[model samples]
Target: MACMEEQRAPGHRWPYGPPWRSAPGGAEPGRSGLPWRSTLLLTLFVLVGSRFSAHGQPHRVPLDGSAHALLLLACVPLLWRYRHPVAVPFVTATAALVYLAAGYPYGPVYLAVAVGCLSAVVAGHRRAAWASVGLLWAGHALVALWLYRWLPPAGDKGADLTQEIVIATWVLAVLAVAELARVRREQWARERADRAQAARRRADEERLRIARELHDVLAHSISVINVQAGMGLALLDSDPEQARTALTTIKAASKEALGEVRQVLDTLRAPGAAPRAPAPGLDRLPELVEQAAAAGLTVAVDGEPPRLPPGTDLAAFRIVQEALTNVVRHSGSRHARVHFADGDGMLRLRIDDDGPATGAEAGGSGNGLAGMRERAVALGGTIEAGPRSDGGFRVLAVLPLHTREDE
Candidate 1:
């Protein structure tokens, strides 16, 4: 985050204070890297502009070599503004005050002070920057109000209190400009950080979606294939006809798994492209039942599934699929039950299986339950999975109908 603030914004107007930290590729349009061009231009402008202002204010002391040197001292510190923010403002302010006391004509000599002060403020040294400019103004007010008699260009009368208004305005203008630059630079930084954080959050959500898709697709299909392969091998010679039916189930399960896996991979290949096939929904519950039957488990689905948002429908399908897969893989009883109903804009799902503690004998990564919970939470829903008191495993999910995810 610290490094974030040092980089430059693409097209911010000010050059002294740092803005957005985009790639510093060869000095962007509004951002400067070394600031050498602007520094040189500023110094030259002060020199030339002062020579003209002095001619116009003849009563003031002329621009001699000493006055030129003091002006140079003030402007040169600006080159080191970024590296030495606090020091630069004081150096420039000191020079401005010394030049004023010497009676050099008031002119563009203040521009250097302004730049240094703004740099300090933008660099997060607000107190130091304010104090530096305050010092210069205080010193100038003293000289112009009382010290004029002892100062150079001897026959001078002290300035009236009314004349202080002009000086006050200049100081006010510098402070206002510095404060504005500080605020705008911070705003750019906040916006940049927010954009970066948002990008990361979106990436995390995508990874999760892919994980759930892969897990649900692979877990359920592979479970069926595992059962059929076992059946085929056990009865390969003892009952050749039964073995053939098992092999055919294996073929169909593998082909469907491949298709679904390929569909998932397609999403990775071309994000934001429409899915090649409609996502599986509760309407495919019969297919789920058939696949379970092939695995030697009985699946009975009760109650009609209602029309739902695509996200909700997909979640409902995945949850039911995962539950039935768990039953086929982990339950001793070959019968599983799935019940779903819609009421008051909510969809309720319940899956149950007769069980007698498969425990360590059942092999699974244990991510299915968590995945179901994630799906439910994303749609403002909930999932509860555990054992029933009557020696059965149960998974219950309550999903919302009005859930909306950004397209």
Candidate 2:
């Protein structure tokens, strides 16, 4: 049964086009023996074409030993057909034609003609393939007819016609099969390229998401704490109690923010699949405020903030952080107030500081304010920041806390 299966199995595969791997910085083999495979198949045709030559024919040319040698040897370099399909086929076909013209019997050399036809097809030259097929058919028929007319074997009169038709059909069938395989290989290569491009795009998007998180969470928090610490230090001699409280706030805010940053990094670097909790939102606002107060920015809260969606909560906190940071930097006032309330289906947060407002500083365009505005806009919200005519800077942000349907 194993032997039977082996017999049924197709022969070895031939590499086409170029060798997939080769010594670097050196000349490479062109075709992957596909042309040789075709040559072997064509050698079979030679056997069939030459069978009738033994008949008592008057004009049949005896098979020349040298011509048979050329036919068998021509396939050696033709193995490079894919690497140099056009060049290899041209050389092989020219050699075969010379052999045929030199009175080499058609019997052993028909193999070379068949391989030339296949080389053209595998090279993806439809025009050349068709021409090669037509030329071989005509050559075989002309040679057979030559022998039949002069050296016709006395017993077999009509057999040559059948042999000619059979060889022609076999050549066509081989060409069709080769074309099919080439098309399939091309399709597979295209699909691989498309998948590679999609994977690159996904990687870029993932990096951008991480960047946003690092900027909004870690950078914004650090900025606010730094501002408050500076103000507390400035007043240390006049208000030692306030300075101590500011240092305490700095420590707490730093520790909490560090843990959150680490959690985000751990999830990003996880080796395999692992679930992670959603990011902290407005539910953690009290803790955020406490940390800020510890840093020496006397913070006041009023009007309960509504239960907000996850994204809105994050945006609200970022807005507050940036506003308070600006207060610590420019506001001469010692107190900052944060107010949250719900009105008209939106959650509003306002951070007000008794900061000096001049034409140069009022409605200022800074990175902190810009980042805050970007977060608000991304969530389909709006922010307003300017001098409150009463000599303080105010930042106001409004965001939808529920879906359109819920509203």
Top-TM-score candidate index:
1
lDDT for residue 243 in candidate 1, whole number 0-100? 97
Candidate 2's TM-score reads: 0.59
RMSD of 2: 9.8
Q: Can you give the lDDT of residue 362 in candidate 1?
A: 49
Which 10-residue span in candidate 1 carries the lowest summed lDDT? 20-29
User: Residue by residue across 153-253, what tens digits does model 1's lDDT show?
Assistant: 78988878777887888788888888887787777667767767766777778888889998999999999988999899999989999999999999999
Q: What is the lDDT of residue 274 in candidate 2?
A: 46
Model 1 regions more than 4 Å off: 1-33, 405-407
Report model 1's TM-score to 2 decimal places.
Answer: 0.90
Clashes in each model (backbone N, CA, C under 3 Å)? 4, 17
TM-score of each: 0.90, 0.59
Candidate 2 per-residue lDDT, tens place, 75-107, comes to: 555555555655565566566655555544445
